[model samples]
Each structure stands twice: as structure tokens, then as C-alpha cells.
Target: MNEPWNPYDVMPAARSADPAAAGARIDALPVSERWKRRFRLIAKAGGPRLPNLGALTFGERMAVMFSVLGLLFGPLYLLCKGLWRPALAYSLIIVAVGFAALMLGLEMLARGVGYGAAVLCANRACALYYRQRVLGERPWL
Candidate 1:
């Protein structure tokens, strides 16, 4: 069998030799186009800002709440008929465990969101710092 051709493998390593193509690529789009694309993506995902509650959107919050509720009761359907104390104890235990698990999940989720936001803000700050240092600060951000 013959190997398939890969255009990337055959492409030139440097674009300086073909400055026209590079200029053409750069000139093809407006500068704010990238940020507009990013904004559109954020809007499509429900919002441009992250929620403090670890829910990126309202739907996500509802889904998480429902899942936790279901987890608290879904196993009870399999148990045989029982008295009030055992059933109450079982229900309490399940809710306690489920709440603990949910708390941990939310904590990890919040940490992850914070980490990502920090990274993004750091990158933006670094970019602004360099622009100020080199270009006399043209309000880069």
C-alpha cells in the first residue's frame, strides 16, 4: 500500500522566503476579528464571564443540582420495604455522602476555573507589559 501524501510535511519550514503569502494572510483580516471570534464563542457558551458558584451557565447549575438530588435517592429503589428508622438513617447517610462528594466536586471545579482565569489574566498582563515596555504603552488590552 502507498503512503498518503501530507501537505504539511511537504510545506516549507519558513515563510520569509514567501513574504507575499505571509502579507496576504495578515492583510486578509481586520485586527479586531480575533477578539470578535473569541467574544462570539463566549456568548455561544452562555456568557463571557465565569460564575463564582462553579456553574458556567444556568443550565449547568440546574443539571448539577438535579444530579445530586438523584444520586441521593436513586439507590433507595432497590432496597426492600423497611421501617422509618432504617429508611431515615439510610436517607441521611446517602444525603450526607452525596453532599460531601458534591462539595469536593464543586471545590475542584472552582479551583480549575480559578486556575484557568489566572492563566488567561497572566498572559494578558504579560502581553500588556511587553507592549508598554517596547511600544510606549498604546493601551494594548
Candidate 2:
């Protein structure tokens, strides 16, 4: 052979249809460019930043958000039922099903708005966390 093999010289386009080609393209990109691409993908998925809730791997964000929403509604449900054990049990079920229904409804209502709200909320949460953790600012409510 007239030339030595060079993996870097064999890089492919980022939009290549083949997985191997795409991997090669990413491997050839600079770290900052790679992160930029990652953030773009997250933004496309309705995240405000690279690591927003929408940017979390698939079902993880869903589980976390659903759990929080369920917790928020739990006390109201218990009050509405007025019985201790049954109220707790039914409240749990309602939270589960209600979360599912609400997700579906939001999808049907306007996916853009729903996802935008999720992204905005995630951004605000991230900002608050950073302020509290790094700046030693305590939140009062």
C-alpha cells in the first residue's frame, strides 16, 4: 500500500445514514462541537439546555415528573375522600392514572406548548438549584 491507514482522515458526515459513519463524524468533532451537537439534540426534544428534564435519557424524566405531580395532588385527594386507608390507596391510583391522562391530554392539546412549559420549568429549576448551591442562597418557599 502507498499510504498508512489514518482513522481521523476517514471521518464521515454527521448526517450520514449509517451508524458507523455518524459515530466517526462525532469522534472527529471537537469536544465543544460535540457538546453543541448534544445540546441541539436536547433543544430539538424541547429542553432548554443540554441537561434539562427533556434532555434526560428517555423515560427517566417522565418518571420523576410524574412522581412529583402525583405527590402534589396526594393531599388534596386524601381530603376529598375523608377516609384514611381507602383515601390513601385511591389517591395513589388516581395519581397514577391522572398523570397518564394528563400526559395524553397535553400531547393532544398542543405538544409545543406542553414541551415548552416543561423546558421552561426545567430551566427555572436548574437556575434556582445553581443559585442555592453555589451562591449559598436559601429558598424560603
Cα lDDT of model 2 by residue, 1-141, tens digit: 236423224223223123233344434433355333543333333432234455466654443233232244443332332223333444465456556757788544354443433443333332222222222233221
Q: Candidate 1 overall Cα lDDT vs. reference?
A: 0.33
TM-score of each: 0.21, 0.21
Candidate 1 lDDT by residue in tens digits, 1-141 = 135423223322322212233334333323355433332322233332212325335654332222232233332321221122333454465456556756778656555543443343332332222222212223312
On TM-score, the candidate that comes out on top is 1
Give model 1's clash tally.
Answer: 0
Instruction: Return the lDDT, model 1, position 13.
Output: 34
Local distance difference test values of all predictions, in order? 0.33, 0.37
Count clashing residue pairs per candidate.
0, 0
Error of 1 at 5 (Å): 56
